[model samples]
Target: MSGGDGQPRDGSGADQPQPGRSEAEESRRGAAYGFTAYAVWGLFPLYFAALKPAGAWEILSHRILWTLLLCLVVLGLRRDLVWLRDLARRPRLAGGVTAAALLIGVNWVVYVAAVLNDHTTEAALGYFLNPIVTVALGVLVLRERLRPLQWVAVAIGALAGVYLSVAAGSVPVIALTLAFSFGGYGLVKKKVGVSLTAMQSLSAETLVLGPIAVVMLAVLTVRGDTTFTTDGAWHMTLLVLAGVATATPLLLFAAAARRVPLVTIGLLQFITPVLQLLCGVLLLHEHMSTARWTGFAIVWLALVVLTVDTLRHRTGLARARAAELADITP
Candidate 1:
């Protein structure tokens, strides 16, 4: 995500030419895209639920295979295969992309398993905890220093984990696995400084995993357990549409990131988890005991602290930039 200094001045020395209007329009458009992307992500439980009779492994394999095919077609049409040559020359980046592929594959399988097994609420909780996990990973892996509020937020998050574990009589393994896997994936992508477009990145990652997915499908076929052929046209279509479903939000998110501020994207990220939680409680009718609710509440509190810190930090940066500009002006 990119951001401006919140100041749109021109050489004319007057904030005219309707720059503010154009910026406002751009921001509005980006926000719309971001909202749609997150909304789609939030409603994924319903989509996965509809793909029944196909186990998690089957769904994951088809998702990978079809997504890779779709991405290849799109890239070919756009003549965007130059990145492949560039990636071939960078061994470290190639390794990072491979690691990213594996991590995301783990994430996809675990998520499918959670949704299929009616653990949608747990899946939602995992996403809700994702930001906290990312922050922890930055501190641990990147040796980044945290702000005071961030430390407080992390401490609160830890307390919530303890409470949840004690209340449930065990660790929330599904949630933690989802959070850590995704966090690690993000870290790897960041370290690699991925320059690929959304489609290109998806293509690269899926290409790495395509062989495994093919092998999985072949084994399923040998065992007469494949649903792609046995399932009717409707089921087949849904499975095939998985590629479109997977890529659309990602493309939208990339568009939004280019047009909007990082802070706006950060705020929008919460929409997905919030919607997922609602879907689990309302649509899926997943049980949310008092203990679970309490744990979620604590996590939300931590998020509130973290968000406040972020906003304040952004505001401070904006003010500092304005002050510097004023000092340099005639």
Candidate 2:
């Protein structure tokens, strides 16, 4: 039943484990998970657009409230409230999560506002710019080293801004806001470390924001300005679905992060903005100027360089590891 490689094989020897098959399978599954997350994120313009009766503020509040409820339910099912207790014992970690919560909360608000205001193209541009922002954050805040190509990639990303300004008529404030806010959130989460699981960290973040969200919702309800009570079933449904939309992609992203190596994850990150840009132009019927396209082209090339550089570095490391093992074997 087993071959020399320990793979289950038939008499024909046709089913033996191929070299690097496990790694390939893992990469495939990770890409699938990453695609699921980014795809959901790409389609967010439609989701936010559908919530027209509700303002961004109300929608964001409900998202926080419902996401908290969902996280609590997950915790109950998993029977893991230990992380919450641990957070209470550790103020520094709690503080980090709190900062991350605030940052992501602002990101949500800005993103929702952008979508509702017909700035989906700009929003997509923001996401397109995010990876380099993340890399820059890593270098500046985390003290991570970058290769020569990576540095060139960052510089190319920077030049895209000038191109956009010249060709796109003006600077994209919404795009920059989204890029920096999410970048800062990523930095904070990185600082928070792996002590808390994704679910637990998200729960902790929501815990920090939930009270404010509740108060805001309560105020809107009292003033009879909230769409939740006034809007019909369709609007209400979408509002509730907002939490699922937000949480599901995040959970998928976390799962993908665990399964995929960092380089693959970086490659997968581009899928989101590409989808968003398509949604913006094709689905949402937004316009794109030639200059804007040129700028986008530059950033796209930079991402290609960065990804290739990452893959090359990882391949080199893998070869080095294999050589080390071979040396030890003799």
Q: In terms of TM-score, how similar is model 1 to the real structure? A: 0.93
Best candidate, TM-score: 1
Error of 2 at 142 (Å): 2.8
Runs in model 2 deviating more than 4 A are 1-27, 222-224
The digit string of per-residue lDDT tens for model 2 on 22-88 reads: 8678667657866777777777778788888788889989888887888888888878787788788
Worst 10 residues of 1 by lDDT: 1-10
* Pairs of residues at least 3 apart in sequence or in different chains that clash in candidate 2: none
lDDT (0 to 1) per candidate: 0.82, 0.75
Candidate 2 vs. true structure, TM-score: 0.89
> Which segments of model 1 are wrong by more than 4 Å?
1-21
lDDT per residue (tens digit) for residues 18-90 in model 1: 3455877878877887787788888888888899989888988988888899989988887878989999999
